[model samples]
Target: MPNMGRKLRVGMVGGGGPANFFGGPHRRGILIDNSAELTAGALRSNPDDAIASARDLFFTRGYGDWRSMIAEEAKRDDGIDYVTIVTPNDAHFGPAVAAAEAGMGVLCEKPLVMNLDEARTLHQAVKTAGVPFVVAYTYTAFPMVMMARHMVADGKVGEVRKVEAWYPQGWLAGSRESTADAAGQKQASWRVDPSKSGASGCGGDIGTHAYEFVRFVAGLTATRVRARLKTFVPGRALDDDFTVLADLDNGGVATIAASQVTIGAQNDNGFRVVGTEGTLEWSITDHNNLKYYRAGEPVHVYRLGGMYNYFPSTITPFIRVPEGHPEGFHEAMANLHRCLEWQIRAKLGEQVPDHMHLPGIADGVAGMAFLDAAVRSGRQDGEWVDVEPVG
Candidate 1:
């Protein structure tokens, strides 16, 4: 059970549309286990939309703007302990900065901000405010992924030699000749627009996830990268596909790719880590199962919720059921929310479980740096580009 001694008072920014489109999962996840409650929210960019969203979500206090939410909440003795930023890539910076300045912990959506400069500024702001900040990297919270991290960290896989990670989607594979003005088209609009989604579209949207996941599981950073980027869709403003060869800090190499134009493929995000001793492989489709290989031994498949002494103890709390009861994407997202809630409680001087520590601002910054460098490298004709190390 989550610690009920105190509920982390929470406020949300951007709940107007699909919460997942903004920051809904974080709010729902925190509230799920009774560890946190949604006290207030400035849910939309527009005043009417914000109020409507708040009422729909049943928030007690609703404000049209995030500034008002922060200001009003700060004056109360029982003010919100944390604020969640779920706005668009361009909109993430303002609310997050405001929340931090108001002395609130934050859990913002990934890609941190629209660009590297904004990411750096937000990082500095959070540090100056001295509050816990988390970036919503939903994949890292998966039980099996956590197990993989543990295995790699414990030398279960020995020294890492190579890694491969990719996220491919077929949603945008339509013929470009069929449509004009892809900008205003629902799915490809904001994403393909450089101004809204940043310099690279698919790279920033899902490629960053691939980069962060591999790094998290293997516990390494890319020192250099060589890449290619493409816009398969005709008349598209940004690259819809990206591929990269990364040089890892630990003398290992990684191949990373993300594409929105893979026809018939649906959410094919997966990774395989190879080491001197053995290998570990997993995919988003078969998220509950992780394959473990040891030289001269039959491969072992570990399933989530399975009773295995070899499983990492760090993931025990996240396992809610016995093995073979499938727990997939949404559950993984919930785990991140659970961790964020615990971290928020710890900040308020309340007891939090040991597994509360998840990827935070630093991880988000690293993801942004990866995107920035990858795009730059791709533009330079796959030249070896030194990735700016993010702390």
Candidate 2:
């Protein structure tokens, strides 16, 4: 790869408040390897708060909103090379489309937009602008996840038959917005609102992660879905629980489930891939290890960064440290940022390895399609619905 020598400049949108859950992770992820620098941002929806927050964070420049940020940045000689959007679901489409239209790279959080139509429109904007775009499917960036993906591709698990992916959290076991005393809950406030969270809350929030996880590891496209989405929390507007049975393009079946109401579960994102020859099991709680099972062989655990010569070459770049050192969420996020940096460099005439991978507009569209199908299926009383294809 060609060395630009200087770090890629980044601008951020949303994730401004001190209590913002994902803002810090994104900032850390982009700067973790010194590959990118946070130079600008429109950090909050409130005009005054946005500027103050940006200044407090030592951003080179700040704007009250994303529009001014993009407009002014486009004119600067040392403008941001890309923008990372950590906004809520409803805020994603506008900035993403605007950034792409301005010919700047975009890295946006998933459940891409409010609806499939918005997703397709955003996709068109990206395609027309010819900018490098990435969706923050954070889990797939994990080295072990990449290893699992490669294992399936190499036929370590032959002809995938069945897949199961689930993401459960206990935070919404009770109403976070309903009670009179819950006013200080900033994160859950907008999340349970239909206008802000869109069609399905839990499904849009973490369920997209589970659905994408299945697609990434099993290398299967969800073709159809039969889904049930329900809101168990009293007076909540959006569904807090989601379950789906999906038909894969290869004729295999998958069960994808996610819930915020599952008591005692905390970020318990996991999956099982069953194939003709073997099975692969993995969970975020024990992120560094992957469990393998076959008919006649004993259960095996593949640890990340293990000095295993059998590990595929594709995953080598993702491993940041020696074996047993323990890399986790932040590291996984960094891996993604690294790939996105490489992609941006590649676009600017740098040579990049063919094996270097990053999920882009297509992945975003597919995720939206999954959410759309699931929502439609839910509305129709669990009737099967086909997932929209991504071109």
- TM-score for all predictions? 0.93, 0.97
lDDT of 1 by residue, 119-164 (tens): 8888999889988887877787788888889888889899999999
Regions of model 2 farther than 4 Å from truth: 1-3, 179-184
Q: Report the CA-based lDDT of candidate 1 relative to the real structure.
A: 0.81
Which residue window of length 10 is worst by lDDT in model 2?
176-185
**Residue 103 displacement (Å), model 2:** 1.2
Q: Tell me model 2's lDDT, rounded to 2 decimals.
A: 0.88
User: Which stretches in model 1 have alpha-carbon errors above 4 Å?
Assistant: 18-24, 175-187
lDDT of 1 at 328: 66
RMSD of 2: 1.6
Q: Tens digit of lDDT per residue, candidate 2, span 227-296?
A: 9999898788899999999999999999999999999999999899999999999999999999989999
